[model samples]
Target: MLAKRIIPCLDVKDGRVVKGKQFIHLRDAGDPVELAMFYNEEGADELVFLDISASSEGRNTMVNVVRSVASQLNIPFTVGGGIHSLENIKALLRAGADKVSLNSSAVKTPELITAGSDFFGRQCIVCAIDAKFDKDSGFYRVYIHGGQKRTEWDAIEWAKKAVSLGAGEILLTSMDRDGEKNGFELNLTRKISESVDVPVIASGGAGKLSDFSDVFIRGEADAALAASVFHYKETSVKQVKAYLKQEGVAIR
Candidate 1:
């Protein structure tokens, strides 16, 4: 069995790391480069840097920030937000990102996924889906443009479509649970994980250490990504890994 990965996320805005509750009322956390280096040394399995406002602001990702954070990390780094074209993905790859996450652009122009995978290989492309429960549809609906807009696509259907279009992995985030310390959306995570063949990274709603184990085991997530808990120092990567190992969860 592959070891479950514990990833630390850097939700950056204006070059600084930030966190918020349910993707609102944003607040500063720290510097992106500093946090990257800290997590690299702190035994994090991987690092994810998201330019949280780039798409909504109608701009490209902050390549400068990507370069700065990339310089400090030896582990795999994934960068996303405001990436619209192949050139944008190329620029980020040259700037040092191992993988480029496609969200808004993927929803707007899905062929980009097949194009990126064809040119750069599927492993270099990740499909990030931000979703929340829809009362009218009675299903999770995909959100885009930094969770500011909703699409008609159902979350489960989109995950399968993204994988079929050549996405190497799925980065699934629960907008309803984002930045909340309660727990991850197990039902959503499990549905996506079971629906996609690619590895699924369960994101959002991670509070206590037990939440990690719960998602990995019950949700069947291949990886778990968290920001607030690690950013606030409520728990460290090493501490979480240790706790997971003790809980009989295979972790790296």
Candidate 2:
């Protein structure tokens, strides 16, 4: 069995790390550089940096910030937000990102995923899906442009398509549970994980140690990513990992 991964996310905006309920009403978490280095020292298996506002603002990812945080980490890090082209992918990788994640841009122009994978290899490209429950459709709907724009595409179908197009992994985030701290959306995660052969990183709604275990054990996610809980010192990666280890879940 592969050891499950514990990843800490840095949702950077205006050069500061922030968190909020359902990705709204943002509040400061800390400095991105400081948080990145701390997670590296804390034995975190990986780090994720998202320039949360880039897509909505209609701009490229903040390369300067990416470079600054990348310099502090030895572990693999994935960078995302406002990434729309091959040049953007190259710039981010050059800025020190081991991988680049695409969301709104990919939704708008899915060929970007194919282009990115063909050029950088699928291992270097991640397709991020932000989703929210739809009352009318009674299924999760994909949200793009930093969760500001809604798409008619069903979340599950999009996941499969991304993998078929060479996305190495899926970074699935449940917008309904983001920062709610209730736990991850295991139902949604499991659905996607089962639908896609590539690795899926579960994000949003991690409140306690058990939440991490539940997602890995039941949701079948390869990794669990969280923010506020770790950023505020409310929970530690080691504690989560130890709990998973105790629960008979393979974890490093």
Candidate 3:
């Protein structure tokens, strides 16, 4: 089996790294460049930098921030938010992002996924799906524009479609679980992971070390991503990996 990955996410708003609950009530975390370097030294398998407000603000991702953070990282990182065109992807790649994640843009124009993967290999493209479980509908609904806009797309259906369109990986976030620290939405994550052939990185609601183990073993996620727990020093990457290793989940 491939080793499962542990990734730290840096959500940036106005160039400062921030964290929030359910995508609102933002609070300052730290400097992006400093946090990136810290995660690099902390043995994170990869890092994710997302400009939380870029899309809503109608602007491109902060390229200078990407460059500064990417320069400090030894491990691969993915950058997202406000990335709407092939040129934007190219610019970020030049700025040193190993992969570019598309959320609102991909939902708006799926062709961008195929076109991006065609121009810059499938491995360079990651489709980020922010989903919230609807109690009345009995299906996870996709959200975009940094979780402000709701779409009719079913999370599982969209994951399959994204892979068919050449997305190499899926970054699936549970909007309901964001910063909850309860645990991952196992059923939601597992359904999508099982439905798609591409790797799935489960994001949100990572509180205890056991949560990571559960997501990998039960959710079957190839990677597990968290923000507040890691950012607030509630747990460290080494601690999580150690617990996962104890639980028989292969780790690098």
Please give the range of 10 consecutive residues that has the lowest summed lDDT in model 2.
20-29
Give the Cα-based TM-score of candidate 3 against the true structure. 0.91
Model 2 stretches astray by more than 4 angstroms: 19-31, 53-61
Write candidate 1's Cα lDDT for 95-115 as tens digits: 988999999999999999999
Instruction: Give the winner by TM-score: 1 or 2.
Output: 1
Task: Indicate the worst ten consecutive residues by lDDT in candidate 3.
Answer: 20-29
Error of 3 at 164 (Å): 0.8
Please give each candidate's TM-score.
0.90, 0.90, 0.91
Q: How many times do residue backbones clash in model 1?
A: 0
Q: Model 3 over residues 1-252: C-alpha lDDT tens digits?
A: 679999998888777777533322233235777777767777899999888664534244478788887777778999988888998898888898999999999999999999999998999999999999888899999999889999999999999999999999999999999879999989988998899888999998999989999999899999999888987778989899888888899998
At residue 145, what lDDT does model 1 achieve?
Answer: 85
**Which RMSD does model 2 reach against the true structure?**
4.1
Clashing pairs in 3: none
- The positional error of residue 48 in candidate 3, measured at the CA in angstroms, is 0.2
